[model samples]
Target: MTLTSKQRAHLRGLSHSLKPTAHVGKDGVTPAVVRSLLETFQQHELVKVRVLENAPDSAKSLAHEIAEKLAGAHVVQTMGRNVTLYRPDPEEPTIALPR
Candidate 1:
């Protein structure tokens, strides 16, 4: 599902305090990293991923790639080296988006 701008804003606010669940280092956005990202999304609807300095790509572009690989998952925000992604949990929804 595509998130509205408000929903994306909400997710960005919620993920502020969250630590990076997955780090993309020199390996970049590999399959293993993608798996970890998917797993993290499964466990937590909102995930914060960090792009290390060794990574060859920018956080913004890398975030887009990860989101594409994650199906419904979308990039909420990219701050510095950190990127936040949100994928609603089908079983149990934790975040309530504002209208």
Candidate 2:
């Protein structure tokens, strides 16, 4: 599902305190990384994923790729070397974005 700009901004703010739950490393968005992301999403509806500098793809590309793979919305917020992503959980949702 696509999130409106307002919803995205709200989610961004909510994810501010959350550290990266999973990191995409040199291997980029590998199956393991995707699996981890999925698991993280299941636990926390909104999560921040860190894209390591060593990753082969840019933060934008990686974020888009992950979003597509998981069929979830993607929010890219960057601070220096880290890129944060927010994707809603399909199963048990712990956080609900503002409507």
Candidate 3:
């Protein structure tokens, strides 16, 4: 599902205070990493992922790939050494982005 602008903005604000839950290292999006990310998504709808400098792909590319893998939408707010992704939790949502 696509997120509205207000929902995206709300999610962005919520994610600002959160630290990266997972980090993509030099190996890039590995199976193990993807699995971990999937699990993380279950708990936190909006999660920040740190991308190490050694990662093969750029932050934007990685964010796109991650969003696709999780079947979720992505917002590239920060594109430095880390990239943030916002995927609404399917269950037990702690924060609800504006619908």
Best by TM-score: 1
- Tens digit of per-residue lDDT, candidate 3, span 55-82: 9989878887877787764763665766
Please, what is the TM-score per model? 0.92, 0.82, 0.84
| Model 1 Cα lDDT, one tens digit per residue, 5-91 | 888888877887999999999878999999998778778999999999999899999999999898888889999999998888888
lDDT of 2: 0.75
Among these predictions, the greatest lDDT belongs to 1
Task: State in Å the error of residue 80, model 1.
Answer: 0.5
Winner on TM-score between 1 and 3 is 1
lDDT-based ranking: 1, 3, 2
Which portions of model 3 show Cα errors greater than 4 Å? none
Span of 10 residues, lowest total lDDT, candidate 1: 1-10
